[model samples]
Target: MTAAAPAPRTPRRRGRPSRTQTETGPATRDRILEAAREEFSERGYEKTSVRGIAKTAGVDSALVHHYFGTKEQVFEAAIEVAFAPALDAPAALEEGPLDGVGERLTRFILGIWENPATRTPLLAIVRSAVNNETAAAVFRRLVAAQLLRRIAGALDVPDGELRAELAAAQLVGIAMLRYVIKVEPLASADPEQIVRRVAPVVQAHLTGH
Candidate 1:
């Protein structure tokens, strides 16, 4: 007689998916960042938590930790995203005559605030940074290390770092009043009008000639 039919094939067993392996790299990171931005915007840094972000992102809290490490790191990343345009300010400043650098920088910074897309996230970051010391530290580091240092380093002057900080202070003050505090004339004035008024002061700080 012919050999008995081959034993019935055992059903293949499927293993549980890995939390880390399933969602690795940029896609997962971006998703977490979007969720972080939303949470930070709605709840502010003081109230926002990793668990809350994870819930918003539909991922386990551990997964959020795996990607970003801490809420501070997540906020920094979100700030980077919101201020991406300003991060490029050094390049924009370098592109033009030194005399015009201030105008270019002013226009670029104000442009970011003028656009609703960039403005909304920026408001979140500024608001949180103002209220939370941890958030403020992150913001200060990014501004000092990324944006200000680059501009300062490019300058052909002594005390470049100080000059850069001074310039940044001017711009930051304007942003706070116009966008955050909603100061009357500044809040309502046209963006170009503000740029025209402020650019010279920034230029003096930067060039100092």
Candidate 2:
């Protein structure tokens, strides 16, 4: 009497997945950022909403909130993603002779615009900032704090902040014309040619020469 051979074991039902089990951290965050970039670029910050970004990302609105606390936070994260490469411009300055810093900075900034991959999101952020004051404030803060100040600090010269800002103005003007406004020959001209011509002016700004 085999003790009625223990009753057949029942299979356990799967419960709702935990956040860790369901969420794919980096990939989901990246998707949200990409969606935010597109939404903000197209609609501007005031009009872009968390629900809209979540819809674009194909994730729940809750997921977007979970990843980035607010719309402003999402926009900031998107800006960082779009500008991460350009943010390293200071490092380029660090690597080479001071004389070549302008060229390095120009080449790096323009390279971002030249590549469609980086340029599109950049265009979006720029357009949003231009159209919306709140967005502009955020963009200004990031540019000033992250890129401009770092570059100025690295220069270690009197009025370095002014010089860095001047150089940024030159580059941003060029970007607006070439990419956003799509102004004539400048828009279509060879990137190297643009660099050669513009780098010297940037050098003057940086070196006061």
Candidate 3:
């Protein structure tokens, strides 16, 4: 008599909750980006293509374009990722008194380079950036826009951006000579020695005293 047996409760559909696009989108994007980095690193920017990235990622070229759009954009994404740890250099300035900021930033940035794990990708990025203008542009954005500009912001001084650039020039020069080009002396010098010598110079730039 009651509610005509409540319509035999249709076999409650039961299965694992399906993954949503939002959940999977990042993984797909990250895979594509990782592929982009390897391609650009091995093949260089000119030779690396969206198709190549897609192939390496085991995705469709359309998906690569869909996520990053254009080869240049993919290169930019890869540059951003490769430089990610170094990009945190700005935060080192915030961790302590401004007076010692130079050393903090110097140690932090160089520490990233000293670690072989982090340095390998950066070396590949720099090599590619050297040979291609487009690659250079992407790398420049990492340096100027992402890294130095943020460092400049933390300085809170007149011409902070310029000062940051100057400091960056010194550190970057060291990285190039010691790490990238593997030049003598610098390449062979003690890490602590490089930090000690360079910190004061960088401090002078960041703080005019």
So what's the TM-score on candidate 1?
0.87
Candidate 2 accuracy as TM-score: 0.85
Taking the tens digit of each residue's C-alpha lDDT, what string does model 3 give over 1-209? 55655566445223321334225678889998888888887888888888788899987676777677778888888888888898788888999998998899889989999999899889888888889998888788778888888998989999999999999888888999999889998899999998899899999999987
- lDDT, model 2: 0.88
lDDT of 1 by residue, 1-209 (tens): 88888888666325322544455778877888999999999999999999999889887777777777888988998889887878888888888789998899889888888899999999998999999999999999988899888998777678888988998899989999989998998899988888889999999999995
Clash pairs of candidate 3? none
* Global lDDT scores for all candidate models: 0.86, 0.88, 0.84
Task: Give one digit per residue, the lDDT tens place, for model 2 in 1-209.
Answer: 55667878666334332465345778888888889988987887889999999899988787787778878889988888888878888988898888888898999899888888988888888988888887788899999999999999999889999999999999999999999999999989999999999999999999887
- Which candidate do you rate higher for lDDT, 1 or 2? 2
Per-residue error for 58 in candidate 2, Å, reads 2.3
By lDDT, the candidates rank as 2, 1, 3
Q: Determine the C-alpha RMSD for candidate 3 after optimal superposition of all C-alphas.
A: 8.1
The C-alpha stretches of model 1 lying farther than 4 A from their native spots are 1-25
Candidate 2, residue 198: the lDDT equals 98
